[model samples]
Target: MTTISRFTGARFLPMVPALRRAADRVPERARLPVAVGLLCEAVLLLWWLAFYPGLMSFDTVTYVWQVTTGHWRSDHSVAYDVLVWLSLQITGGLAALTFLQTVALAASLGYVCHGLRALGVRGRWAAAAPLAVVLVPSTGTFGIFVWKDSAYAIAAVLAFGACAHLAARQRPLLHWWLLAAAMTGLSVFRNNSYPAVAVAGLVLLAAMPRRWRRIAAATLVPTALALALNFGVYPAIGVQKPSTSSYYAFNYADISVAYHRAPQTFRRSDLAVMSQVAPLAHWSAGGSNCSWVDPLMAPPFDRPAAERLNGKLLDTWGHVLAKRPDLMLSAHLCRGRIAWALPRNDSDIFIQPPVVPADRFGYSRPGGLMDHSRFLPALRTDPPSDGLHSAGVWAYTAARTPELTWFLWTGSLWCWATYLIVLRMMRRRPLRSALALAATTAGLQVAVLVATPAGLFRYMAAPVLLGFLALPLLTAAHPADRLPGADPARRGRARAAARPQSAPPRSGAAA
Candidate 1:
């Protein structure tokens, strides 16, 4: 073969012209503006890695250990761990692992930039937004954290974009299938991330044309398989018993007890006390009167002592609700307040005396591991709290010449508001998209608080991921419009709009 033909056969040939076109399309004068953005990203990334690598949060260490040991059976989704394992094998040390982490983070940030560019943002501007996202001092700041959140967020964005592309009829079957696999992988990453995958599946379903029965078929088959793997088949095959902590058990116990006692109202305090004790009773040695579910709710509940107290409290709550009218309203409202104001920490952590005691029984058990875990120590020791310490801003403000905490809070609230506004706008034509996104965020937050052993502000990262993706699109001027430029190559393909609107003719067919 001629040298020219051999060169044409190389992989780079396909992408070479595209690169040239990008250069041609971007005005020569735009280089400085683009360079400024790239330089800013470099500076911010360096600052984060140097000072607060991984932000050293509580869950990070467990993940680090998991990666180092190549032990992943305990983890739900092992993608990040798998990546770390591969990177470590290649690099062979902690320093290499750290560098690998930054590289992975940069790649994920680049993917976010790609999403932005597809939405009409210039490449440089798109790139800078993810940096701004990283600099926002919220969930994105944890980008370097070894936990699955960063990886899950990246997977989610990729899945969302792929599903969106399929919806737009831009990508092929192979791409959608790959995206589906990633979504499934993400579902197992962290307990909270499962809902995002479920929502992504819904997006895929919505994107497909109704005539294609296979779309619904495709969506349901994977989810069904996942269910079988998680609940039905996994256990039967000895994979692992589904870990059901007492947290969810308690919620169910509370609802069930309330249901039985509902006809005879109760004072809110009465209900609260009853709700707290029922789970304890269920787990009590002699307290068979409480349901099995109560035990589940009180996984850490002390046997006889917890059950005996819970039974009495349940009866007391039922009696009080039966008797007091005004107290009922007070009790119902109080329950709502408690639910809303509930701490984002594992109740088990609070169970320990000396608050942040050296020995607290966490999910892994004997529970002292709880206190030893990364975030738990900070939660116990980090004082002045958000309100008292003004979120630790005295030093930050001195350095930055601004109240970073205050600014972060204000900016977050504004971004949150913008997210809601976008949801409202999308609700008209794409209500399912808006609702699915909203539900994924809100439902997971509610579920996480009720189910998980740990609850931290960082737990809210999944929702924030969606909010950032939707933000630029929300802020942008155009709606339902294609990006500004057409591929000059595709200009020839742009034919009569008057053509029949069913599916386009198969490739190579004459009009």
Candidate 2:
């Protein structure tokens, strides 16, 4: 005879009581952090178990090859490759790396949730904000996926969330260092992320009211670290560079589209330069596929020859862009459509079946490319159990659902939304500090648009994750009052410290 409303209010999950009891033991001000920590860690544990060694793809296999073979390259994220190496050494597999990514993400979002709570958001909802951000189909699936973009998204969230936390109240120097680490780590995990993190640091400098010298130093951390690692440390340590031809992949698209649409558009000399890239057939055939430039630059494409003729290719592409702007621009836009306008791009990068492909790890199955003995003893895949199967089904369907695809799966939408929100929040002076978060997302969007070889869903992940985390910040409420049993002196000072920060400080004011 119990009503549905009663069940809605009921704590049916056994873990709820334990989490509540644990939170109750902490001081009132510290309760949210403790709860968030416990919740994030607990959920990640279950999520990791279901996927076991964690999700992997061709890129992961490459990383594994590097680790197992002892040959390393800087084409991919070398720092991230080292992380994979460490995880493999510790767990003898990739599970630990996935765990690190998910936990770090949950921890970062928890910081932002706590900041929202401090800003007077409702207690339960603000505490649950990180849970929502991490548990979404796209994000939850990515949690187990072994990709640098996943870690890149986590670092972006950390940098963004840390900025929100620092802005919420008077924070210690430790908090600034936290932001510094997140910003620096952002680029280290993704080769193309330096520009985004660099701009984000500038956003930090502008948003912060004081501490110019210290803030400037923190701002330069990513720039300095990125440059030193790329130019000095990498070469010093013997990290071989990947094919330089890949660096200019996008140029292939420009030249291909021009030759494809009109063979006569190019002069004899231009045609000669074009052939140096790939055969005319590769260009014409690859033109039909604009999602990526890989087809145009595929096997038998003479990569070293292309590298030598880089100047000629650049000239050809530049000529195409100048003379046949329509074709070139359309091709570029089509290539990067996922970065600008993929509302229905439900293709979450979760390694869909989460099974080992037939062509990897000393195994071969139907439809697999081939088999290799690389991951023999170190890594293997699990047969999808009922729970894992159900979860995969959920992730797949939830991604395709039209209702969620536009908002959750499509990242470009979030990027545009973040910019719009930043513009609106600028009118509310006290909320301007949040622009630092918006700027980081915006910068990432720019990076993907300009540099990404393909418009993959993973490129837009940061904005998607941040969009969900930003929801609780919209709540309007008073800050939680101090409980009677808490330390009165400490609570009083905490409230006092928080009150002054409510008013936006003028530029050049002390921290």
Candidate 3:
């Protein structure tokens, strides 16, 4: 007569043995699959390094210069610079530097694989599919390239792995603090990453209350100090450069604005043209809005560098919030759009010439090229294949390569959907979910070619890694029936239930 619930309650502690036995049944050598997967990934990394030898598109040159020169001491992305410097010192060539990056990424991927295995995802075969899907896409391209994106991806995987371990194990305050510091360092390394760290920290706080405030405070203090060192103390000491007030004139702003005007269909084409022209126009228009000015754009003698930057960052936020609140919201909302933009399958640089067949003649269409409404048709046909490829080129074609256009369109849509899901989820658990949401959103803001509009998929790499780490946690299986603790009263009731009713016993005896 023992009820199922009663039996379950008595077996709680003993279930551990059952679970272990189950785990043991999962083949001792299952790790071989993961090892092989890593090997394949390593091969891909090596091949890309050998063949591409550093694709000449987007931030490739600028980042190389930053590491080689070691100028921007307070420029935030210090870790990546340090890694690059270390590579240059050791190997003595940019190719060597790229190899170093690939190795770092491999290490990060290894850690991620370990984390997945720890979560009961047995065998490499089980892990390979998800890992391949994420590692490929635009992310794969970044893995092989030596860029901030690669470094960010590496640091992010490490940080997130650390965080997931800390969270899953319910570790001590000290452990959480250590992970927070590591995350802070990574965030500082990439300017766009700071907001993401802030957001993610808040999300972690939402989930664990015992040490939530302590964890959040620990994270914020170090981050604030890092910001001080980068924008404030460093500039004051002349270790870093100061800023100027000319950002509005920068072409990125104009491009962002242009995107605001365009419908979602051809945002990639719009961003492509803007990426080429915006910064120059911003520079020509005269001001320090371009990120390059962070080191060289010194503050006037009237105020301390830290104070000046604090004021500027504050003012920038204030202006955006006050004058363009809607734009700010739109930007965050646009994270969804940015996330799903399709891969424009076009070459990152103008290396390969236009390959359209003569039958695809609509590509040669003219007129209405400048208009947003005509933009999609133009992008579909013209394929701007080699038209205005380099950063140095002056003339703007307004036409986008068809493949590139489709990629952006697809990437934008995917980003938007994820953004909305994150947003909706965060509303209920603000502290815990906000960071994931923000990281997903803001990370996309920089990831897509639209906001920062870098060609390499590396820009959005942080969120990409985060999404990977989040997968296991999201799909964790619920214990069908969590065994309850043994209770004497419940045992007594079950014993009583085991006895037959007295009336029935009497009737049987009479018969």
TM-score of each: 0.53, 0.82, 0.53
Supply candidate 1's per-residue lDDT for 242. 29
lDDT of 2: 0.70
What TM-score number comes out for model 2?
Answer: 0.82
Best of the two (1, 2) by TM-score: 2
**Alpha carbon lDDT at 292, candidate 1:** 24
Tens-digit lDDT track for model 1 on 1-511? 6987788778678798997787678654343334444554464455344433223333444544455543444334444555556654664422334444445445544544544443344444555555665555453444544456656555554554444334334446764574655456466566545454455455445545451354444445555656665566545644434233322334333434444434345456654554454442332331221222433344444434434455555465456455654443343332222113432222311111111223322423454434333333322223323442333233223423223322232222333543485465455344333332333334334434333422233444544554554555443323343323543223224433433578776786654
Once superposed on the true structure, which residue ranges of model 1 sit more than 4 Å away at CA?
Answer: 1-48, 51-53, 63-105, 121-125, 163-169, 207-225, 232-300, 303-455, 475-511
Return the lDDT, model 1, position 1: 67
Residue-level error in angstroms, candidate 2, position 274: 1.6
RMSD of each: 13.3, 9.3, 16.7
Model with the higher lDDT, candidate 2 or 3: 2
Q: Whose TM-score is higher: candidate 2's or candidate 3's?
A: 2
For residues 155-178, write the lDDT of model 3, one tens digit per residue.
665565555445334355654564
